[model samples]
Target: MTITSQDQKVRGKNSYTFDEFLEKRSSLDWYKNDPILQKALKKYAGAKYEQIHNELQHFSSAVSSRWNPLAERAARPEARPSMLHFDAFNHRIDRVVRPMETHQLEKEVFGAGLFSSKMPAWESFAKRMLIHQLGEAGVACPLTCTIGLIALLEQYPNEDIPELEQILQHTKEGLEGDFAIGAQFMTEIQGGSDLPANVLEAVPDGKYYRLFGNKFFCSVAHADYSVVTAKISGTDKVSTFIVPSWLSGDKDKEKRNGYEINRIKWKMGTAELPTGEFQYNGALAYPVGPAGKGVAIAAGIVLTLSRLEIGIACAGFMLRAAREASLYGNFRTVFGKKVKDYPLSVRTLKKIEDAAHRTTAGAFKIYHQFLFLDQPLNAGIPVDQPIELRKQLFNLRELVLLQKICATNEGAEVLRDAISVFAGHGVMEEFSSLPRIFRDIVVNEQWEGPRNLLLTQIYRDIQRVTDWYPSADFVANVLEGASQETIDRFAEQLTDLLQRPVCGEVSEASMEAAEEWDVFCDSFFKAYQKIALEELQ
Candidate 1:
């Protein structure tokens, strides 16, 4: 599937543009009555979550209407032969080309939106929308989020508010066609999760950087542009840049851009989304953020939002999987009883349902915290409150990280169990949505930040508090309103963990235990939660 400039046409019409959908939905009282979402938004008003939620139903409905038809058609036996070839091509475009374009637009719009709004609410809202609507496209969403953040850093310093707004508007307009597309640019042969260790080198030129590297697992091959991360020449620092298909000199031709798409990976899932490898040389590029700040900025700008979305997307996948499994279990019978009526099946369904609930609640809570920390809030807290508020913030990070890890890992397990209930039919592509969903969930595990990396961060945070256990006054202030029992429990747990000194030794057994540290870290978070609840009271 060659990507010629002529093939780049804005595909399908949106039922309503984002603004129109917002205006129409806001007029409905049903939206006003949504208590759960409303309460969640109030906790972090800066998230602009209400705005995102208000538009979500409409956006989801539109996307479903547009794509479900294709999805269903693609699954049809009669449509398979022709659609299979088309899908193969479509998958390439969705994985590679689409991600590139979306990333560019996200960079442009989000960058401008962040600084202009005077609040981080919009960031949270934007991230929520991406997670909810594009669960399968999680990889690209983060790339886009990162681009937007980089853009904000680069363009905002020189542009006024109005100019920035215009830039944002232009970016949103460009992104209108992106959801139907996809984005890609991850996985190098030498590095899977360790992006900092990537060997893709970028040589400095007058105004641009020249990128040469072999990129493994390019997800969306048909995109118009790609945000590639490469190591800067003569330095270990990683740098990010945008490479447009047309910018490499041939705007009209469909020739390869110094990169040959080797082959699409054969995978157990997400076949509809193509994943491939490519070798490219001297791909002209424009630098994103400062060269050295690439890794740090990527973490701040992209991974955080991405990690948050991974949690949200995992929740969505679990919800859908549970809903489908429950529906199927009710209708399908075994041994003269509905599957759902069986004790074991019922237990499975209940576990999936309960997990979905907890995951959603946890995600909403963290989303609010992220908004509060990043956005404008009423100032003038008493000086005495600083230590407590700082502690709350620290706990918030731990909670978010824990939720992201737990929800994603658990969501995948839930999906697997849900699919298992369907027996042989579950494994069949046409018989269940579970297969596609399962594939997508696999990617979510690695999205934003990998699970082990997050757990390590959580461990470091816990260690910090242990090293200098805050004074009694500080502790009391932080948990001022907490019950004595709850406070004592938290203190006891922290003390126990601190006393169990990590020898920091390298051994097979220690390595095995180290890998399981996240479980312990999660228990620590539970303790922090108890402390937080006391403060809230």
Candidate 2:
């Protein structure tokens, strides 16, 4: 055989990519193999371990094969969903036209009861973890809203409100038939974080109300129902109402509710979910609870659940990024040597991997506490729990805010570090998921609560509750698995720090002191997270 010039050219050029033709996935028994995950499951789930484990494995496989591709395809901004404000003949119809990938992913994930709390505690959270690990694959946000709605439904079991019960049942039993999704339209054009300042107008109409206002950020805008807040024509109170996507009799004609999509938002991350602006034109709504309780209920129910899931989702993001980075580092070469062999590269990879593990450990630890505390809170008996339960629950509430801060911030940091290991290929969208996950984490950093808001909330909370809060005592409980010396070091420091509250009127000096305290609290929480990881082990 004679060797041709083209054959020589092909043989001389390298076409293989990093770790190609390899399985490049975690073991199928992901839940079974994770010691820390199982430990957390046992702490809460007990006898349901084996069942949950099998379920998690099945979900993991489906996510890896089906969701991964679907999400990647839909994540492109060009492939993003569009809102149809008119029917084929150009009549007004507020219908969201999403890629088929989104509908399939939602049906697969939510229909599998990923949004249900009715499953085993650990199992429910595990399914959510899987969905979130897909990183805003157009489903997690709506699923999150639905989860909050379910939690609120538990609080307000209104038998007479057939619509509430009907929609709630459909979301829970979506696996059976008629899968429903939920969303919240809280932030208005004038207010982003100021929930109480919303000025959406609501006029009484028989038993229902008609709303007219604009919502600034409406993710999952295609959801079947929205938990919206508006002020009654004569009152200053902000009240919550459940608004169906389409009016009761309109389903037959595919008619929409009394709202129109102003425009879909162009965001930096999580393009799979179509977040948009909307104008409510006398949209019929039903009250969720007593008037003027909307802001409180919105924060207590919807935002709380969203923040809790953000921590886990961010952790999931870190885990995925770290795994891919480590696998890449294992096989990649630089300067004529394997990248992982280099001391600096090894340290970076270790840092990313450790952060991923610690984040996962900390998130599960919170989920364990969340299951316990969320029950009493949802029951509206905040003061009814035993002192220890009360204390842990209170701490968990503050910690949920803190966890969102730390998990997402660290997820972004570790993901960037993971990208660094990939060198040139890291920034390329097609190379790996690092870039998209990086963007998702950045967006999540600002979701539910921002860093400054959360940090101040923690510091202020420590001060406000200092009289009853044994800061050292709470630290000791969470750090039960740490070394005695380690426990004493952070406990003593946090106790002393918590004791010094800024006294009297606000001034430049006190403001400066608060900033310094914020830095100290940041370190204090990182140490606490380290202790949480140890405890999980």
Candidate 3:
């Protein structure tokens, strides 16, 4: 943990010493008391307190090994650029996107039982790490694709496990080293989010499909391959295809595929990642999943997991921002005392802490639900209906949506408070990461389905129990002795929302109602907490 001359240079102006950094990195004290988390981590991550230090060391070494060589080569002032250029940025991203880093982490951590007993630990770990890594990026299209593929795999009961494994391995290898893959589906021209609404057509030739169309809002233009969702000939069904940067029978040798990058998007946040539009003729593609079911599959698998990850990422970003603010308040002086000494600052910090704790708790609660649904017992069955299994699945989905909504919304609020706590220092890029964190929060909100879209989904779930409330007994059990007044109030709101037809349709009125419904659900969750506390008592 010694601070070498090099370490001292890098750590300049940072509050923590090198030894403190090492200690913090090595310790799991942050998570130690959470038995559920400990069990899950040990089962999945293969890291106990005893081995966590060594494991962290290994992870650091791995990161340094790849970065060091490139750092050395670019040490020349002339070779290094002031800004990370597009090509260079793309190259760095491509290297990290591979399966070796992502999937390997999954297999080693969750799959290997670093914490507790769980099946398909690899999938679970991948999902977790994706959140940990890309949550900050905001609109990470490639990350969405990766999770979507896993979800799709889960749907095919008869798929060969080995074949699926091979596909994942191939995808990991292809994506490794790329930070973001370009998204070609959305367009100013296209009216809907549906890909079939896409005018892009792919011609079939043996196993490959040749694409011919222009797409807007491609997130990662520098990616090695573009997973384009296009319409296949002879049917109205939309299908996903993998189109590589380099392909056969192309006129522009250096250009490889016929696609030409049009322009990069200038956005409100996440400016570091490029979003672009492109047009191509005869770009080769390999089909993903079955034809026509692309939208359903995307929603169920890709969008859902991405939404969950966005929630998790928001929580992490909020943690980092809150920690920075808290540390600053402890040191910065105002009125002849540390700002933290002031009751107002203390209250703000406490609110951040409570929010963070709730977000983590909510996310973990959903993660457990994901584990439950993924278990073999629930496989092949529709997530809804079937008595016992139905209840578990229903709760799992509801909790996941709830956490996604709560974490993203509250994370944004916490980040804003963190910025306020730092005063002038927070807004400056040099003084704090608050600005970047704020951008990250905005991105999290936009990613997956937007807040209103998610709220509507939840309202639909609540409406499903029209005649009698859905999970009424469970709600009562959780809300027992909650002053009945609060319970009845929430029940009344729920009944009113359910009575109106708001599910399966997207309208301004419906969206407003959904937002109100979400508020009611929040109150309901608070009531449940009272019930849980009474049970513990």
Q: What TM-score does each of the candidates earn?
A: 0.69, 0.92, 0.70
Give candidate 1 misplaced runs (Cα > 4 Å): 1-57, 63-66, 72-171, 175-187, 248-252, 255-260, 375-397, 464-491, 498-503, 508-516, 523-537
lDDT of each: 0.55, 0.78, 0.54
Native-referenced Cα lDDT, model 3? 0.54
TM-score for predicted model 1 compared with the true structure: 0.69
Query: Could you give candidate 2's per-residue lDDT for residues 398-508 as a string of tens digits?
Result: 778778888888888998999999899899987777898888889988878688777766766666665666777766776677778877877777666555544326887
After superposition, the stretches of candidate 2 with alpha carbons farther than 4 Å from their true spots are 1-12, 19-22, 25-44, 116-118, 249-252, 378-386, 483-511
- Per-residue lDDT over 1-537 for candidate 3, one digit per residue giving the tens place of the 0 to 100 score: 787998777775666333442333334222332233333344444433336433434443432333222322322223211222234335311111211233333333222222222324433343343234323332344444455444444455333324343444444433243222223343324734444477778898776778888887666555545556778887787776666666443323344565666666666555444566667678767676677766655555555666666666765566555555667777678789988999999999988866654554445445645765663222212635566666566566665566666676777888889888888867875455567657667776765556667777777665564334364543543355777676676666766777654563788887777667767766665444334323322
lDDT (C-alpha) at residue 167 in model 2: 78
Could you give candidate 1's per-residue lDDT for residues 1-537 as a string of tens digits?
886666555445355333432343324332233333344444545455566566555544433443333443443323211112223344322123323333443343334333333435544453443334333432334334433443433432333223323334433333343322223364688777677888888888767777778888665555455656788899997776655544434544444455556666654444444566766677666666566656655555445555666666776677666666766777676788989999999999998876665555556556656656653121112245466575666555556677677777777888899898888878887665677677777766775567777777766666666433352332344344566775665566545544443335778755665655656655544444344322322
The clash count for each model shown is: 17, 0, 30
lDDT of 3 at 68: 23
Stretches of model 3 off by over 4 angstroms after superposition = 1-144, 150-167, 172-189, 192-196, 248-255, 375-385, 464-489, 501-515, 521-537
Q: Residue 368 in model 2: shift from native, Å? A: 0.8
- Which of candidates 1 and 2 reaches a greater TM-score? 2
